[model samples]
Target: MFYAILAYHVEEAVAALTPEEDAALMTDLLQINERLYRERTLGPAARLGATQDACTLRGPGAGMVIDGPFAETKEQLLGLYVVDCATRDAAIAIARDLRRVNPTAVYEIRPISLYLPGVPFPVTPS
Candidate 1:
């Protein structure tokens, strides 16, 4: 299975929904999530926090931990969702479907590579 990254910017790309609208959209998102979950094709999906909640951790001379928000940009990364799929096209279709249902938001879809020391990445090149 291949893993996909669904990144979106809510504040900029989407308008705030009314209470009723919020409920409806959430229901739709939930339904989509349910379908993916039932198929066993879903891996771990999550909605990320603000970039300010981000931290940079890297090993320089020893190790470095810096605190601060992500650099300013045109838009902020508001959330993310990871899913397991059979192909990039499948993942792309899912993202497109999501966009159609949530026209208020703009999202990007990309596959990820996890190169563990021993374990192979979940996805392989086509």
Candidate 2:
């Protein structure tokens, strides 16, 4: 089964990280990602851009485009990871590994009901 791990974190808290601090965190996270890749369980993963750069289209039909996520929450969705695991516990274990490296971030794991493999594209590291 495939699970989607949604990462959430306070925008301000994440933004406060120094370049070195951020790089160290990413390095640790990537190490785990590399391991998952070798295991052939890792799928598409992405770190979303800032909410300020996001737009929301709500209402019926075409809908109106609104600026920002506009969600009333302290922590915003930061990134996500998709992994193929044998069981829910296995998926949770993967999230635990991510939490070990990023203690401040929150991960919500959900089983994927339907998955569509879209066009493949090269992902440039940030």
Q: Which ten-residue region of model 1 has the weakest summed lDDT?
A: 115-124
Question: In candidate 2, which residue pairs get closer than 3 Å at backbone N, Cα or C atoms, i.e. clash?
Answer: none
Clashing pairs in 1: none
In candidate 1 the C-alpha lDDT for residue 116 amounts to 25
Q: What TM-score goes with each of the models?
A: 0.68, 0.91
Which digits, one per residue and each the tens of the lDDT, describe model 1 over residues 1-105? 556655555453344567787688778877888987897766666666556668877777868888855546566565666777779888887777777777756
Highest TM-score scorer: 2
Residues 1-126 of candidate 2 have per-residue lDDT tens digits of 999999999988889999999999999999999999999999999988998899999999989999988767678998999999999999999999999999999999999999887797797787
Give the Cα error of residue 49 in candidate 1, in Å.
2.4
How does each model score on lDDT? Answer: 0.67, 0.93
